[model samples]
Target chain A: MNEEKKISGIQFASLAFISRIACAFTGIPNLRTNLPTSDRISVFLIGLLLSLLLALPVLLFIEKENNRGLQNREKPCPSGIGRIILIFYAAFFVGAGILAVSRLGVFASGILLQKNNLHLFTAILIIAGAFCAERGLEPTARVSVLLSAAVLGGLLFTGLCDVGKMKLENLSQPFAGNIPIIVREAFFEACMNVELPVLMLLAPQIKIKKKTHLLLWLPLCFVCISAAFAVAAAVAGHYADLQVFPLHSLAVIAKTALFERIDDLLASLWVSCTVLKTGILLYTAYVAARTAVPACKKRCFFILTGALVFGGYLLLTANIQFFANVLQSAAVPVLFLFATVFIPLFTCLKNGRKEHKEVAKQ
Target chain B: MKILAIFLCFLLTFTGCSATVGTQLSNRLIIEAIGIDAQEDGFLVSVLALHTQQSNAANATETQDSIGQVFSAKGKSLSEAFAQIDLVSGLVPLYSQTRVLIFGKEIAENEPMQALDFFIRNYTLRESILLAVADAKASEIIETELEKNTLVSKNVQDILESGKNNGLTVAVELYQFVNRFLDETDAAYLPVIKTQENQSGKKEITHAGIALFAQKNLTAVIDKDAAKGLLWTAGLIDNDLLSIPFKGRTLSVAVKDCKSKIRLHKGDIPTFSAEIQFSCDLIEYNTDDTLLFNLQELEDVNRELQKQVQKITEEFIRTAIRENGCDCLSLLKKLRNGQPAYYAQIKDKQTDYLKDAVITVQISSEILKTGREVVKPN
Candidate 1:
């Protein structure tokens, strides 16, 4: 990557944080095992720990490879296998992008704009996301920093407004539910943090002065997500179970002496975060596509990636029941483990073996 | 060229597929309050909607009425009734601005959830909207005409808020009602509103007391004094005036800074205790005794006030819990939080557990200030 294309580690972490927190603003979605609202804080904390463990391979790969990104390392692999791996990564990014945009569409229609056309809003968001992606990763990463501040400030404002309403009785004992179900839900929750893979792919582009910045992201993400869930449970109580999006409902009721309703403004901020996450995923997909097929023009791949993501979004949302089932399925976590852990671990071992063989020959 | 093409695409997409926005403020019936009464075959739904089409000058001149107009429709369901309202007014009903939801005594007693499910499920309706029960038909209160630029909805809301502030009634919002309703061990309660003729012979809305519900049924309507006790136990009391008979005169103290804590002790049957602490300021007196400034006299008044409060609260607990079998004090919630294991064991028979449980009340009051007349009258 060129010097102009490089971003600081803080910016990179901001990108990942914004992406992860956007999903949280939508509240935990449909799952095969429904975790009670009171148990969400514990489950989310467990999920964060699991995600940290799963991210070890990616972190080790970053440590061993001397700042070479996953795409950069693809060129050194066996020829056919390298292209296939790149293609797989490209597909993963596209799938992640589709899921993010589709969720935003559903939230917009269901909560914010019940009278508006869902497809039109989604298409507009996809177009804007593609435009942002085409501007390259450096600009997107810079914007993420500003958006992160807005998100945190909005959360604090709303939290303060709702502090008096939070009841201690609303919170229940952690792990009070079935053990197997809690673990299952936690695993699925960890899988939804697609930013882990994004970080792996984008590692080379981040100019790191220290590794601590990268290590700090997981705990920070955990604190933010768990606090949000706890507040939602405390303020909304069991009524949260009836809401499609408890955070949105909380926002609807949150008021200060000056402002009667701020859900509209807060919803806008959340949607902006979703758009930023989609843009980052689209850019990653574009980069992966370029590596898979080097002969294709950059513009062609970018446009193709955008078109494919929008097409995938349409397919997923066409049948609501099937989309819900897919969300609850084990497929997402399997793919997440593959892209974030399996590939990075395999590549690290393969490179180490290659280095040993070359030394022996010398 | 690229920028222009993008701008054109944006314009086309936004203009072609935007949300319908043709309904002006005049065309929308901005609902201020709603009243639902159970009928023989269906519900008589009445809405107090703002008459936006009225000019400001006309509204000012017609301040006695016409600020809001009430529209009623009957149907088997709320949605169907609302549809009929839309037809009658030829305007879309906007529920986002609604301030209060009132249900008739019959509906509240028979099927509150059935009448409230629509508002609870509505995306546009706010969860913080004040909920109340009418003493009789909700329509009577909603349709009550008031003088001097008063909206019936605003009047009802003010009455409930004043009642809540003074510790005479417990104000319940939509979400709180639903939360308690969903908790099988807890009972839900809403402030009761009644239409009464004022001294001037004009109809006015008043806060009668509170309607207590056991699960889904309205079990009892506790009076104002009992409602105050409920507020004291629930720590919902902010400020109230306590009048105690002392030495052949009435001594009024303004109570403030009230707090309560409930502790549950587990056994074969659980025992619950509520410790309440509050501070008061001497505000009024029926006698002109100069010795009121004496330290011993203040102590005596404080003791009498504490005894009165304790007596009222204990009576409320007995009437609500033992007599009516209503868990209005949320002892079960306390049990669930304080002793989850014990709660789980008794989860199946929570009603029986509540009926058999022993409750103790402790009240403490300190006279923080005696007001401006420190020396009393000469």
Candidate 2:
């Protein structure tokens, strides 16, 4: 059903960017809304920098440990630690996918559909994402490039129309309101971007000069997300203070000479982008499943991963409040564990502690 | 597992449960405008909605404008009012096409932001809807009809647009209103409308200057000249006409263009000055003063006219600041923008800064054309 050809560097970069910033484009968190628009945007950028920095070490460790294909892990040990790690990776992917779909659900219901309609749309999306993941990375990466183009174009189109309405002076004010809250929001926002751990899991699949290509995608995503927040702040101003999805609201209010509201267009485009993002995460989950069970065939891995994800989506989303609480509590610790503890420990075990010495010298 | 995957795929495609039905055109009553007024019990909400059924198709063929009437309801909250409206209006009322939002004097003075909050929070309303305060009841303004089958909402929108062009009122859209309202000092202003009965017994609404607000209270209603001065500082002034009394008669000048720049002179206490420059073409010269035909004489007249404009605008500014305690010129914003360090020193006592600060207004007018009858001063 799919070709085995390795995707190009540009395609990988596209996929990486689409997955990382898809949610960020929705908005930076509104937790510290009292801070000036300038302070809010600055904090989000700072948090984005923190997220990137935290993710980089994990990325390097994964590349150093497994320079070859991503599918390779280890024979199931009697100790079962490797199995545990693989399972963790799979669970993280599925968990992140569930949350991403739930976010899309919130947006869709709020903008265009009823609550029940959004659930059905989410179901359709999950099944479609699983189907795409079953095909392979090549197709997924290819679709991501096209979807990235659409998402970027939609964002740019909506942003350009609001330029006349925007007051550039809105961004000139300094951090005058609340410092501690702004700092907390900055870190909380950093926790929202899933790129960090996703990249760590998919490091071996990256073929192009790892340092160069990743450098291209990561900062590109960082700047794109930061600019989106800055644009929303400048365009919407005090109005954006309470909106659940500021960027989408910014689009809803933006009007060109020919059209009244382009928000519908923007929502449709984001739906596609979010779906593509889900597909990539599902592919990552499938790869994790294969890594854990060497005896599992590609078809069997796809079916198992898809089944587990669909079931998780159904069970976890029954109560959104409970899911939100679970996600909020687990966000910081889980991110730290995968990025800091898991990466170094696994890398040292695979290549011996001497590899750590070499890495330090680098 | 394969069977499970296949079964799920089958369910996803085949067992199609229609998640939701989209709003149909026939089911929705498109709202053209909305009006809010304060009542003794709660709030009265009125909407000018499109009538779905065509009474006579042949007569309706030529008219592209939708025929509408104002349907009103009373409730404690905006949502509750909307629910009452929905119950009365059989079709679902949609607000995407709402062009004007009229606020009655009571509502605008008592609860402007709270009323505006409902519109802002409702996803159906756009940020560009024209906002105005009704000098009378908002429901009366909406229910009043006009010639050419024009909706009262459309008429109000046109009035604001044309009045802004004529320099009678300031141009304030929904976003600009909220922007100005959220400024450090809540001194945002909106155009005021009053309904008058014409000789033909038809009701005609007129935009009478601007209604200034201090927070949620309607503090004062400034006349056209003061409104023009306020607009000149904050917005564009287009097609403004000026009349100057020259030797025994009046010389009317049509303003072609104008620009204003505020240069802050920080002293022991900062003094702000506005330098306004305007270009005008003399349209009429009623005085038969023989010297008026000379170019030199016309220049002298223009110099005198410039002084008069400076005096008028300065007086308007003084009244706005002293009488109403309004920051009509945004001096605080300017100072904060230009001299941040100086602003920080006076930040603690900012509320009193406008009262104490000395503002100077200077006007410079250039005569673009003296007309065919050139005036030369002796």
Candidate 3:
């Protein structure tokens, strides 16, 4: 459909990095808002471990598949496993794309736009993402590098300036109240960060490095987000849990010498991150969806992919919390089963079947 | 085609989207201070707004007509009350510039739930608004025109900042107050603003003391002196002054810095203790001791000043802890952080534990500049 473009490991890494931290702007996973110091720390550690577990399979797959993700043109599977991989990747991408839009919709209603409905911003976001998706994956990854800077800048600015307001004693409970909830929250949170699965689908087009992007990316993301979580809890204290949008409230409360109303400024900067996150998910879906139609080109696939995601968002926008619940309860186990378990098992079976056929011919 | 594109660009810029345009400023009223009073059925909300366009108008104006207007409205809910103000004045009331929230004594004494819900839910209002308990009806504070060239809001904000910086009262922003209400300790304090009649019969607002709250309910109103003690034990001191009577000569010095390190003891019973260290610079003195000019006199004065401060602070602490049962210094929080196991043991019985616990006040002071003691025996 389009000429193959090889992207560097860092650009690929940057896309994954932005996708992971962008979810944190609304609320970081695993860390409870305004929780006791010890419990917060424990939740953050558990979330980190689960993400690493899911990410390891993708790293191994990219290395074993000779830097190709799902886009290997040379190897064709018997028993129609290629069709299965393509359809599964497509579904996962579409699911992630809708989740990002819905979360942004729930957060933006009456906060940034100062209106009761988020349709305007959500529609604009979908259009911008579709435009980016039309340009293909490398362009989205390149744009991600810029979006990454803006997102991190806004996050750090609000987090750093609220130092005077921190009340450490508010977060002094050094022990968790409930272990089961902590573990459950951590498991649900790992799936919310959909970048790991997206990376597995795109590894073929990327120039694989000996030390993959996850090495530097994961710790950077965890450190920055964990710092944000801790600062938000320390500054907001007992008021943290009461906030509907915790980070937005933190931004609303924080002020510098020259700038007040940082919430508006940061929310505006987040528009770019939202588009990039949305674009990457939609682009991944396009790569797999194009496999089904022999005559379908990349541009048509991109348009169809955008149309389906936009329709899905329109239908699901009314119940944002429903998608959030589905993500935690169902999405994590299913994504792990496919990305970590099913994909590897099927690929090995197909490879063994091919090797047996060649030896019999000899 | 190019001409059509240029025409479209010209059409697009027609409906401008600037928030601070000159015309819009006239329709928007910037409220700088708000006063809320409880009534039999509804609430009386007073607003001090900056008449932006009128103030900027070129005219011969009197001191009383300097663009600050106080408007009052009554309604069941805060939103309804504010909307009524708009209906009466026809100008949109913008709370973004509001710096102070004055609560009538009656409302503060009863409960602030109705007003607090509106404030916390409103997206336009900032959490940094300084909350103060008015001495009488909040409308009186908003209505009393000050003999200044500024709005009442600016005056109140400056006074509150000065008092907070000088350790005269605690700095309680709306966010901090809400946080304390949500805290497990269930105690917080707000500065009290009182209107005093001067000799000329002019009424002016002044800082009286602090109003203590236990989970949104008013518990006690302590004076400024007790609040200063709370500051001392909490290590939040700014510009403090101490006058000492040392061997018949009064030594008054400006305190440079006062720091407190508090520790909570846990065992048979949990106890709270504070060790305060202060350094001062001599500003003025009326003494006839020649030793006052020497280094020994400086050491003696420092020691006596420490004793006098210790006694004053101890009295304030006793008033807060024993009399009112208010944890003004957040000793409970310190216990939770510093000693968790002990905190767990006494989380349920914190008030009783504090009552039985021993409180010790230790002060050490150093007088840096004992201005040249050139006064010989008069």
Q: Say which candidate scores most in DockQ.
A: 1
The candidate 2 chain A region of ten consecutive residues with least summed lDDT is A69-78
- Chain A TM-score by candidate, in order: 0.95, 0.86, 0.88
Docking class of 3: acceptable
Q: lDDT, candidate 2, residue B127?
A: 72
DockQ of 3: 0.29
DockQ of each: 0.40, 0.29, 0.29
Using lDDT as the measure, the top candidate is: 1
Using all chains and alpha carbons, the TM-scores for the candidates as numbered come to: 0.93, 0.85, 0.88
Candidate 1, which segments miss by more than 4 Å at Cα? A1-4, A27-31, A74-78, A209-212, A296-299, B1-20, B55-65, B266-270, B375-378
lDDT of 2 by residue, A195-274 (tens): 55666556555566655465467667766666766776776666666566777767766888797658766666676666
Q: Judged by lDDT relative to the true structure, which candidate is superior, 1 or 3?
A: 1
Query: Where is the poorest 10-residue window by lDDT in model 1 chain B?
Result: B11-20
lDDT of every model, 2 decimals: 0.80, 0.70, 0.71
Query: Could you tell me which residue pairs clash in candidate 1?
Result: none
Task: Compose the digit string of candidate 3's lDDT tens values, residues B1-378.
Answer: 436433432332221122223337778878889999998887999999987766777661653566788889999887788999998889866776798999998888887756787887776677778888887888888887777456778877877877635778766788778878767775788888877889899777788888887656778888878877777777767668877776786767888767777777775566777889888887776765444455666667778888877876887777877777778777888877777787788888877776766888888877777666442332
Off by over 4 Å in 3: A1-5, A27-40, A73-80, A116-118, A299-304, A307-309, A319-341, A344-362, B1-23, B55-64, B246-250, B266-268, B287-292, B338-341, B370-378
The global Cα lDDT (0 to 1) of model 2 is 0.70
Better of 1 and 2 by DockQ: 1
